[model samples]
Target: MDGHHHTAHSVFPKVSTTGKKGKDQKSAKSAKKPRKAEVNYLPPYPTGENEESQEQERIQLLTEAPTNPNSNLTRDVVIRCLIVYLEESLDHVLKRYDDADEDSVSQDLTVQRMKIYSIKTNTSDCPDDVGIVVEGMKVLAALGNFPRACSMLLGLTYAVNVANPKELRYTFEVFQKFLLELDCSKLSPKVNSLKNKTASLGKWALAK
Candidate 1:
């Protein structure tokens, strides 16, 4: 009987439920360790090649306009797309004519700016802000493209009707700042006249 009892006890080894519970608890705790979260982000500034590709994509989107006459191609959407195209065109101009004269370099830029203004003119409801145009002028002036800068500034001023006093003042301030930084000797008589015309417009607003 003793031998049978020993055999039975041995066959059914005493396993503590507490031990099993502890093991499970350990596994659960281990499984709950925090991991670093992964995130994907877009680049702030695209490379030259990326700019070209993106511009082409935007053009393709323009061409593939919905056939339906009732399609919603909003002015804001078109303007945004055109702005992107202008940026891309500027990049292209900079890249392509790295060694060209200012006149030659400004050709493409002039065309693009005119095109943007033309679109803005057509969409009278969408008021043109001179911010982007001012920025382009600043860049051209910095690059010693003074004549082109002057021409662009004058043309843009005429094209964009800044009825908003705040916007007009701000645009003139930016333009005047650009003029101040220009090499006076490089500026033509026409440029000087243009500068004189806008002389009364100044008093920069505090930056937001």
Candidate 2:
């Protein structure tokens, strides 16, 4: 009985030692395990630096761009309005003349004529007023009013000479061509006589 008890006691010690060894090995493995890295999440949005860079790019693009078509269209509209105003004023003067209101016609004509001169002076870069004057002279000539037409033409000649001397030679040549093409027999007797005088004057003037 004593020998059997000793053998059982020795077996109990061996089982206890095996259990302690397994526990130590598990603790060592747990300690050696790698730690997981931490992660952060952010909402999608532009940062301050990114926003500033985008703003600068936009400003640079605007500054380097060409002039817009809308701006050019606005300028063209303004010019057209000025031309229409001038035409309406002249038309009013002509209407007064047709109504036989001599004094009123003369006043309106003088005012409108001065307005044309003002336009030419202010818009020296545009020669549109010269074309207007030429058209007015043609209308007067068609109405059998040679004297008034000639006066308008003379005024145009003077204005062109002073304001745009470089264009004067071409303008005079056009005027001469227009006169030569007219049928003299269709003109009133007074107009025919005046035409002969103008032809002589034009020849002399051009010769110089």
Candidate 1 lDDT by residue in tens digits, 30-125 = 754323221111112122333345556545544444453222335334433432532323232122233345566445455443222211223344
Clashing pairs in 1: none
Q: lDDT tens string, model 2, 48-157? A: 32334545654553443244545434544543443353232222212223323435534444434311221222423432122122222222222122222323443343
In terms of TM-score, how similar is model 2 to the real structure? 0.19
Cα lDDT for residue 199, candidate 2: 88
Worst 10 residues of 1 by lDDT: 36-45
Q: Residue 5, candidate 2: how far off, in angstroms?
A: 99
Best by TM-score: 2
The residue-level lDDT of candidate 1 at 3 comes to 24
